[model samples]
Target: MAEAYPLKFQENHKSHWARTLRNLGLAYHQIGDNTQALDYAKHALDIYARLAQDKPKRFEPDWAMSLNDYANLLSDKGDNTQALDYCKQALNIRERLAQDKSEDFESDWAMSLNNYANRLSDNGDSTQVLACAKQSLDIYARLAQDKPKRFEPDWAISLSNYAIRLSDNGDSTQALTCAKQALDIRERLAQNQPERFEPGWAMSLSNYANALSENGDNAQAIDFAKQALDIYARLAQDKPERFEPGWAASLNNYATYLSDNGDSTQALVYAKKALDIYARLAESNPKKRTADAERSQLNVAMLAWLITGAELVVSAEAAPDSALDYDRRPNRFYRHVLLAWAANDPAHAANALENAWQAWGAMSKAQQKNWENIFLLACGFAAARAALPPAFGTWQVQLTQFKTRRKAGLPQWMEEIARRKGFALV
Candidate 1:
């Protein structure tokens, strides 16, 4: 269709040409080709801007639309500064047009406001973000009341956005209310047109879950997160290019909820899955996926630390006080100890180990029994005992006996330490 227009027609019908370029940009963006999308969007905006300058009355709206689309492409490329500038320009035009022709342009005005609010959020202007989002919600609410079929989805989206803003601002009660309302509308919409509305329904579910978690209903939050994950998983299986990002996001959210509910082991599994997807995505769209990948990587690391720490403590608790048996150690424990030793950064490692030891010391016996309360302490104690100077004489004696019994099987460093008297590993 784009090739249907010859150079002569393109020169004569610039508006049509620009629209085609904008649409091509959208097509590329939908398939995750951000570089191509950005190129096409730039060209469309350039043409639209020139046309609007010559005939503002006829071309201003189209120019604003192109500006908005270009802003979105910029945002996907992590060019927030440029995106925000374009959003402001688009909103200015849309706002003026809506005032002059409210019936025809009100929706565009509201949509622009929403876009502006999001850009403000990306820039950390929380106060303006909420104000603009609220204004957008008000307009959408009125429009939806009068024309449910046409405006309900927009209204629901605004509600979800508003809910997130409210939650971020420490208004959990109001956030939950708005989230539930959005979820209700999306649920009804999906009931009638699953293919068209299910993605929105999944998004609403995720938003509602976040609200629920904020309100301290972690169980319910996990349930809703699971629902969102299930939907995204199915959708991504069919259209990975379109849905994988959502699927990865849902997995991350689900992992968070699970961690909050005291299932760090399970959380680690899902967090790793999220990290894998985000890492793969970052390879193709680093600007868009880098932050997500970094966040997922952090989640994975923290969860692994806690789980591994707990396991180390549990294994130590089962060992005899007379001797630390090398054969009794779990592979995870051995791997962790070996890794810490190999890193050879004793100062920082010692500090972390000491902090963990102090934390374990501070815990009550009952709290100690709940490994979650002393996982770090246990991990610290095991690492310090295995790789550092003898902090406890009894453990040092046990270590000496264990090393003597397992000299042939010990790691090179440990065997070397056992061969020398009063030699510390760190």
Candidate 2:
């Protein structure tokens, strides 16, 4: 047998030191030490960067690679600000390399554009994100046009992301159009190569369902989501490790459609199944996957509880019953409002509570915390106007006296209620 030299590390080599830091970062990240991983990652990038500055021309590829590495790591760490900086730098390097070297060829350009656009979108900058996603779509579109049979799958994904971003930014109509176009492309591809392209079919079906759901066609959405779920279930069961989360996610999406159409019992069943798959995945390998996916499992469990009024048993639980680790706060508030309304006016308040609870129960945590808060507030105002008693005027007066007497110790929700009633004595 031939003798092999053992790997060795030296103190003075900056490159080796950078590599060491990166490896340590991954190790730390694996064990759920985000802070330490972030520190090590930053140190590695700093060293790589110093080397790039020392030899700018020779280190172009290294520089770009390091920037992307840092960008992705930081983005995962949720430091989107610094992640944006690194992504932009990486884009600049890639653009220069592709333009000045490869004449901006399709393969390299498309890859770079995809990463750049996604990162820009990740940080929630609409203008730049839209521009980059559009540019990438254009590139992919052109490539697919030039070689339809070869690049169709890639093009389909880009178009899907393009539509998704548009939908996120409130252009649901345009989003449906984009999604439809991608579905057309993918359908054709799947027909041409069914054996190799089954996943593409599933993706197109799921995306079409998403667009339909956004457009309020929940009937068609449910049908399409079910079709996708069936395909993904077969594909995933055949290769569990390879397709576990995708199938689980399809089940989740299908369940969401059911939940939206007032079939939350079925939704709870599917969400629970998805949560099981996600839990297994998390236990199998947490560090290698996105935390967003793990968080989503928690979301499913929370929503299941809201739909069924059943408590979810999760791995991360604490006694105070806080909403931080749960996605059921909207439903919780909706229930509180219902309790209040039952006490106030059981007839009209019944309808008010019903509508409000539906809206509140269906919201995702991200949605509830953001623009949905405004909608919730607006709905509260509308409900109050519609359901407020004639005695509310006198009630407001009483609330003013109560507030003045208890200003130093009023609970926040009580204070909000008083303000909402326009009960101001000052």
Candidate 3:
């Protein structure tokens, strides 16, 4: 259909072709055809971008919308670095449009800001996350005040994002308030339109529960988290393809809270459940789901280690007999195990570190040059430092060289991983 439309629509009708391309891209995305989705989205974006270069007033908004759509697809495909770049393009266009006509472009600008905030948050870049979320929330608040029925859902979404950023920034008290306000708005909306608003209400419940947990209200956190889990569970049961990810995410969140509250047994149960769901999803859609699967696997390993007082030994049957096993372990089990043994089981931790080092040494030069691979190696090194700090004296020097060689800013998630393991990324 997309090919037929392009053949029918000549170059003079580029706008029509671009719009069709964008629509097709969206349709493909809805059906989980990410490869075709990206192809169509990029084609639309290219046409719009070229048109906007000559007639900014006529095509800039269209181009920005295409950029946003492309970013969403890239994000879903687990290419967040590219996603961030596309989101910035959309936000820049929207910002300019909003400045010229605030009433007409403010909503779009706010939407872009919210999306930018989300991508940054996912990448562990907390520096500008709060500011972008607040800017989006402010716009939504004003719009909702003027037309509650039309803009209330957008307002609630912005509030929820703002709450997440606030919680990440250590302002959990205000985060809880923001989350609760979003929950109230979603609850009201869902009461009238369950099909439209129930998912949102469930999301808000999870966000609010997270804030509650951060604020040291474990009981309330567990209660709200359970409510979110119940909603997601029901939704997933009815539509596994769409809602399973949400259910898995809720399980992970609930498990973390339970673990923090000294319920290791239940927490392990929930974490394993989340991992099982992620594994199934990854098997069905490897390109889009593998990252989530790996993270959930790590979470399960962490939970098991914690349940054993951080002294879980490598199973004799499962122990690595080859470099292939070690290579797989760095990003999955070994990294988590290294942290668990940082102070508790130094002998095993040293063994893990030695295996990780051997795996790193086995990588080719080209593989080491890739940012994604480098980030994973950096994380492995950080975990090794936590388990054996003195062994990292030379690594600090090498890290400086690595930073100097890279032109782009360091990935914040690597630092986050290191910080979680009680080490700094030198």
Question: Candidate 1: which pairs clash?
Answer: none
The best-first sequence of candidates by TM-score reads 3, 1, 2
For each candidate, what is the lDDT? 0.73, 0.64, 0.75
Candidate 2's error at 139, in angstroms?
1.7
Q: lDDT, candidate 1, residue 314? A: 17
Candidate 2 Cα RMSD (Å) = 11.4
- Which candidate has the top score in lDDT? 3
After superposition, candidate 2 runs with Cα above 4 Å error: 1-58, 102-107, 190-197, 286-426
Task: Identify the leading candidate in terms of TM-score.
Answer: 3
Candidate 1, superposed: residue stretches over 4 Å from native: 1-12, 27-36, 279-294, 310-426
> What TM-score against the true fold does each predicted structure earn?
0.69, 0.64, 0.72
User: How good is model 1 by TM-score?
Assistant: 0.69
Better of 1 and 2 by lDDT: 1
Q: Model 3, 220-289: lDDT tens per residue?
A: 8899999999999999999998899999999998987787566767988998999999899989876556
Give the number of colliding residue pairs in candidate 1. Answer: 0
